[model samples]
Target chain A: MKPRVGATLASTTDQTTVIVVRWGAEDLDVTCGGAPMVDARGPEAGTSHPADPAQQAGTVMGKRYASEEHGVELLCTKPGSGTLAIGGVPVPLKDAKPLPASD
Target chain B: MNITVLLDMAADGFGDRVVVGTREAGLTAQALRARASAGAALVEAEGADAILHLAVNTPAFPVALFAAGLAGVPLVPVNYRLGAEQLDHLVGNHPRALVVADERQRAAIERAGLTARTPEEFLQQTRTPAPHAVEPREVDPDSAAVVIYTSGTTSAPKGVVLTHANLVSYVLGTVEYGAAAEDDAALMSVPPYHIAAVSNALTNLYAGRRVIVLEAFTPQDWVETVRDQGVTNAMVVPTMLARIMDEPGLDRSVPSLRSLAYGGAAMPRRVVEQALREWPAVDFVNAYGLTETSSTITVLGPEDHRAGGERLSSAGRAVPGVEIQVRADDDTPLPAGTSGHVWVRGEQVSTAYAGGGSGSSLDADGWFHTRDRGRLDAEGYLFLEGRVDDTIIRGAENIAPAEIEDVLQRHPDVADAVVVGVPDEEWGQRIEAVVVPRRGVDLDAEALEALRATVRGSLRGAKTPDRIVAWAELPRTPTGKLVRRDVVAGLAR
Candidate 1:
């Protein structure tokens, strides 16, 4: 039988969301915007996600949904121009860089 | 002598009364013999050298034994609770062994698609002459009689070899210690595949006692059985004992119970104390052993239950003919009061493992290193601290899980408990406790923190748990051993 998941949401916003995904099955693929969020290279990395991710994000309209309702935040900026934060108090995002959308 | 001879002796002693079987299908001596004749014919047709019997709680066990004995084939009882992979490994490893199962186990056999025969069909097809021409094989004292796979608590299961001599010795030893008599009656709830259950059966058989076997134990049924049957003795685990003690009507229901023998895992002092208070007339025995020893090696008798005495925290002294020693990591024997790995040597010790197993757990010097850490008091009583593998390294200090489990169980709200060490980068391993609260009791972090405070007050820092996770029920093996590793692994995620 599949184990029941017990998770409580930290916060959620229109641009980004942070949900506690307590991983019941191991080595699970947890994704944000169809991109992997957890490292899957070590023995600890199972076929399923192991724990609830404290952070998750995506781009919305022209502004990046950097910081969601949760404490976790995402960063968007041009190289050498510092960074931009759209939510949860604007601040310079550390090591922020921009890239073109994948084909 | 062959086990058949022993069965015959029992049949001769018990006569038409039930020798072995379930309540609905109990068999007398004549019926048992008839079934054996039928089973022998079926074994001949199957083209298998031996029979692999698999049933958790069947009345047909004694009949199967008799049939195998008459057929001059070995009977290996497989634990039904094991997974498909484990069954595949055992069956593939023992190609010559044919499975004899009841309807309940047919699906499992078919899933593996292994060759198997139903108990009824085996009886029908194997019906032939007494096969008196075939004499029972002489059992070598050191040879394997049954191969019981160890619970894969730390690793995969390994088949433990138990010789007939070893089993006989253990049974005889228990009979002597427990003072079992021919008139005694035993109530058993433990499964037969486990060493303790089998040993209990053997002990009863040797004494010509009437053993009322329960298919399994429910709290209500257990209490009713003891009360109704006037059961003189019972073989139980700590969990079963706790359940019975907590049962509402238990005080009046089990008044007839005279003796309660428990083992397979350590019992919490509070549970033991409750049992003692509820059933003051019953003698409580603490037995310690493994499948490798065919059952018991050390027995702490009822007299050792003295509170605030030297034997209070001990597992008890070694039974007659058994020797226990504590050895350091270097294998050097430690003096009394020094804690280390507990080693044992006795008449009941199995010579080796089955299925090409290799280990010197039993060294050349004849001592079997039990992998349990404990000290011997000046009075020669043994105290089991915990398994060497279960030890947790918190910072620089090592902690034994049993010490913490004992403390947690003493809490008024805690009904059952198991302690495990989880991996932690900062401390190497941190102690975590999984607790099952008493029925109808509600507990929260604040209550657990209070419980931890009680532990600290009673046992100081070493026995305190780092974290407590409340569970509805602890996962356990079919034999009722707490699955500490699985619990810890589950919590780690």
Candidate 2:
């Protein structure tokens, strides 16, 4: 893998988007719609892995983002169907528009 | 009543000699006195009540001395190895004490819900344009000077009471017998919170020799320090010495080292032999004592080392002015060559224990019955068999585990050995040996059987260990004393 930049997308065709924010050192701060979300992995999981998206969705209802900055990995999840607002900015989902058929 | 006066007098008495050295700080007797005077002034200005010293292996020990001297209060050197619970116990036990600690220990102290000042803050409080000086006090021979906590075997740590006179006696005895001179420079890598380090520092200071203190012991750092600093003498436990010897470039690096003083635990014969071969010119002394005695009461000198295996097996004769004897369980004195309780009486013996008053080990007759069981040869040399409590009673016959462990440690494949007695229905206790083999050495059941056969051929049938258990390493105290109780408890688990 080339090391994905954002929170893992669900089914590759979902209109929802998850964006990750990176911080200093090894700390990972994962937030969704201005609220903190528990990473997807089990409670005993390493900070890098969020194994259960459903469990995290119940805890934090929003779109998500995951990013690596300064050696620190962050995963953020956002909520809603169309445009998601995080850190006072709106991010539109690419899957919201229909894709053209290829030969 | 004043410690500064005594230090000043001592400094004047022995001038132009090196007193203390850290990698960053080096001071002669005159310089140390000057620095101490400056530090003492700071303590006076700060209005500190008591100095709670938490720096165990730092070069800032002199600051503690200065603070204690100026404040005219007790210096409580807390062991850093303790957890917050134990630290809280110590703090609650001694209230109104000003804490002196380094940056690394600040969080722990804070976590323990205590406030402390950095050494810099303490110095700032006592800073003076011209350092105020005080005369050394005429300390009572029996007055408590230093309170050291014992490495507790079973219960919480207890403070050992050592008086100035007791320390003075210990220093004089060791210096005189060990032939310490002003030209000598001793390296101290052991933690300053330990009695060994404190006693060694005090003795070296009194002798007007330089003391080079290492923050911690690393084989490379030890070798480099000895060579670069021209260190002549050092005190170490057997495990540390063994590790240093195992370091790749130790022999070529530590050529300037002259004397190697071993203590904390009995020196295995093989380790001593290896040390002798590696550092042929260095004088190896086996020091035997406890926290109560300050440092060493008996010293097996270099001449004894030269005498080979037989002498190596003994803990050596008592140092001058110290008398030693063996006593039975009923307090009756035993004849020479009899295994019994070891009793010692000397000026260096502590007058009492903190919080509990005098210890029961010290009788009205003035003799302190050390719980160690040992015998004296015809030449008056003391041979420590083992602790009386550690003796295994197998089929009604007492077997010293140390005796067997000593033999096992001599095997070529064995790196270390510890012997314990497990519960047995018939014998009451059964002998079990725990061994750590040398790195990369393969030891199987047959090899262990052959080693047992070797032991069987060398020792009596009753002394042979019934079981041999190989381990990666033995559990040790922070000060490097083998944890026999922990080992036995591990076996039960």
A1-103: candidate 2 lDDT, tens digit per residue: 1223322322111222232322344433333333333323225222322233332232122212222223322211323323222332332322111111000
| Over 4 Å off, model 1 | A1-103, B1-5, B8-17, B21-25, B28-47, B69-73, B111-113, B119-133, B176-183, B249-252, B306-312, B357-361
Candidates in order, TM-scores: namely 0.75, 0.77
Residue-pair clash count for candidate 2: 27
- For model 1, state the Cα shift of residue B290 in Å: 0.5
CA lDDT, every prediction?
0.63, 0.66
- Alpha carbon deviation, residue B6, candidate 1 (Å): 3.5
Scored by lDDT, model 1 comes in at 0.63
**CAPRI rating of model 1:** incorrect
Please compute DockQ, using alpha carbons, for every candidate against the native two-chain complex. Answer: 0.00, 0.00
